[model samples]
Target: MKTAEYEIVRDFAAQREQVYAAWTRPERFARWFGPRMFTTPADRVVLDVRPGGAWQATLVGEEGFEVTLRGVYREIAGPGRLVFTTGDPDSPGDGPASVATLTLEECEGGTTMRFHQFGVNTDAEHAEQARAGWLEFFDRLAEHLAVQATSSKVSARP
Candidate 1:
């Protein structure tokens, strides 16, 4: 069976640890895990966040549809890199699960994140949609990080 893949490179105005925490911390992840019109509640997100550990998240759409994604962590190098396999448990026999890798590099001002996902069980068009969805998710992440930064600054005022 044919498969599709995509890679996205983005730079965030936050430290590598801050960006990495957004993915590993369940509370932070819940704030930006899904696309627009979808919410992933904190209680529904589980992140074991270690090699061989399992993680799962359920995003509920505005219209009440739910998408539950489950995965196992293949590698976890905190604040640097992460590798995992993700798939929808509801869809059995769709194809092989996709493997996703997130690499974070600390630059002069912030962090550069390289995200890649492969082995998607779909055509190019669907793969494009998936890529778009991930972009949306990242946009939300940026917004969340900005808010966190602002809050941290305000709290630091003495």
Candidate 2:
């Protein structure tokens, strides 16, 4: 039933340091990474950003309700690569965990980063939906990365 794998490659004219920071830091994580389809909590984010660390996020439901996502980081290859699961409670079992991989490569202008989500086939419709969802998310990410770069430089200026 699971039958969806997708890859989105985006190269930013932003600085690599800023791009790397946005992906690794939890503060930056909340700004860009999320469904963003509904009203999401910008402050309710906790990502350890390391192997064996926890990644938690909570979104308030209608009329004071809250939904949670609990998972752990499975792999970390420094600034170049990162692999983790979003909803894997026990992580690395028979059940497929959503695998998120980010790769950063330097380019002539700035940096080329590829975002890949490889597992999402629980159902035919779900797989298709995920593909569409990731495409939208990547678009958001591109904008966020650029802003992050500009903000960092402005803050660094004395």
Candidate 3:
């Protein structure tokens, strides 16, 4: 048996509130959940961002390789932290639904986020790849935030 712990950090060019909004809001989520060179469009997405809510994503690429991921939101700390457990709740040993925590800290010019995932010691291989994929997605999120911030500023100009 092996254990795996993977974390991700990102500095977005937007305020904490905006960053948080992008995650909790469905429309915003559909916009940037996809990474560069990939598209996790709104059509193939389902997000319920509340305690005990479900989060699902199925990315269709190439042939019939569909990636289905499901999770439940356990704790939400406004624009600061979001905690969740992965895997489905109906099955025993269903990957244990590892606990994941995403925290946002206000920085000088923007927001810095730290993503911590635990309870992965039960399954190391899959968790490792998931972490890598998450990092890539975060990069795309950064790009989306940058553009969104610019748009917001432009719209606010009087």
Candidate 4:
């Protein structure tokens, strides 16, 4: 079967550790895990953040539909890189599993994130849609990080 893939690169005005935590920490991940029209409750997100550990998140859409994504950690290099496989939890081996890789590098001002997902069991059109969805999710992440940065600064003021 022909597989689809997508790559996205983003730069955030936050430290690499902070950006990595946004992906590894469940509380922070839930805040920005889904598309703009969907919300992932913190209770619905689980991130073990260890190789062989499992992670999952269910996003509830505005129209009342739910989408759940579950995967297992394949590799984790804290504050640097992460690799995981995404597939249906209930039904394994039904199709090719998608692998997602995220690499974070310290840049002059902040962190540069490179994200790539491949091995999707779908066509190009659907893959493009998935890319768009991720773009929306990243937009939310940018906002989340900005808010956290502001709050941290406010609390640090003496």
Candidate 5:
């Protein structure tokens, strides 16, 4: 049997453009794209951030194990939405790919991000792991945005 699609909605206290940049920019993306316990080296990240472009990154765990994520952008709508196909780079052939759609909406105080990932087929254990990983990843992303917003505000002041 195939695993079900997963969707999550998160709100960030940052401008829509800022949140979008954090997701699309390689330098910023590598800082928070992995699970909470993993670290992504700056030199190991590559993000093209355009329709038909490719993005790749490697995450290193505390034990030095590496996980490579490779993806191709399917659609790009400025700072509002993005769709991509992603999978494990080390898998045989092209690996099991999933389509991810992320939509960002500007709200009263910030941005609301709706994320949906489909076409995932794995064992129950792996599906649960993936869900947990995404939750942790988003948690890290929120933290990164908070720090960026604070620093930006400080720098903007005289």
Candidate 6:
């Protein structure tokens, strides 16, 4: 049976490199990479941004539920594209692992990030929940990027 798939596109008022770094770098990733009700501590995230490199993170939810996510990078095309496979460590993989592709385009205002994931959970409800979670995560990411940009400007001032 084919699994559910989901896609989300978000535009940020930040450069492609800044957005890409926020996704690929461990410290930056942990800042905005989990569900809104969860916290992904920086020290609990391990990332390697190269082909075949592995990544793992532990998310602690507000209700005290903890989730561990693991993935491997399949490709990294600098500030434009990234492909990876991600899954919960405790879940049994009945079929193929979920593969995600992120494409970043530099636009006049900032960057547009297209996030697509295939072979996710088998149910539509799960996909919907995942989509909502991603939306929250992206909102947080945008805020983080905006703050970073402001800080950068402040630090650059003479």
Best by lDDT: 1
Better candidate number, 3 or 5, judged by TM-score:
5
lDDT of 6 by residue, 73-115 (tens): 8999989999988863225467335788999999989999999
lDDT of 3 by residue, 1-158 (tens): 34567788888879999889877876677667654555566766777878888887666656666666668899888799898777743442535457778999999999999998875435777777778778887877888898898898899999
All candidates' TM-scores? 0.92, 0.77, 0.84, 0.92, 0.89, 0.90
C-alpha lDDT score of every prediction, in listed order: 0.88, 0.70, 0.76, 0.88, 0.84, 0.86
Candidate 1, residues 1-158, lDDT tens digits: the string is 55778899999989999999999999999999988898899999999999989999999986789989888899999889999888732252765467899999999888999999885566787778878989999999999989988998999999
Report the lDDT tens digits of candidate 4 across residue range 42-135: 9999998899999999999867899899899999998899999889423445564678899999999889999999864667876788889889
Better model by TM-score: candidate 1 vs candidate 2: 1
Tens-digit lDDT string for candidate 2 (1-158)? 25356777888887667677776676776666655653345578787888989878776656877777657778888777777776662443555457778888889888888877766434556656776766766677778887877887899999
Runs of candidate 2 exceeding 4 Å displacement: 1-3, 39-42, 60-66, 89-96, 156-158
Determine which window of 10 residues in candidate 2 has minimal summed lDDT: 88-97
The segments of candidate 6 whose C-alpha lies over 4 angstroms from its true place after superposition are 62-64, 88-92
Which of 3 and 4 is ahead in lDDT? 4
lDDT of 2: 0.70
The true-versus-predicted C-alpha distance at residue 21 of model 3, in Å, is: 1.5
The collision pairs in model 4 are none
Candidate 5 lDDT (Cα, 0 to 1): 0.84
Comparing 2 with 3 on TM-score, the higher-scoring candidate is 3
Better of 5 and 6 by TM-score: 6
lDDT of 2 at 125: 64
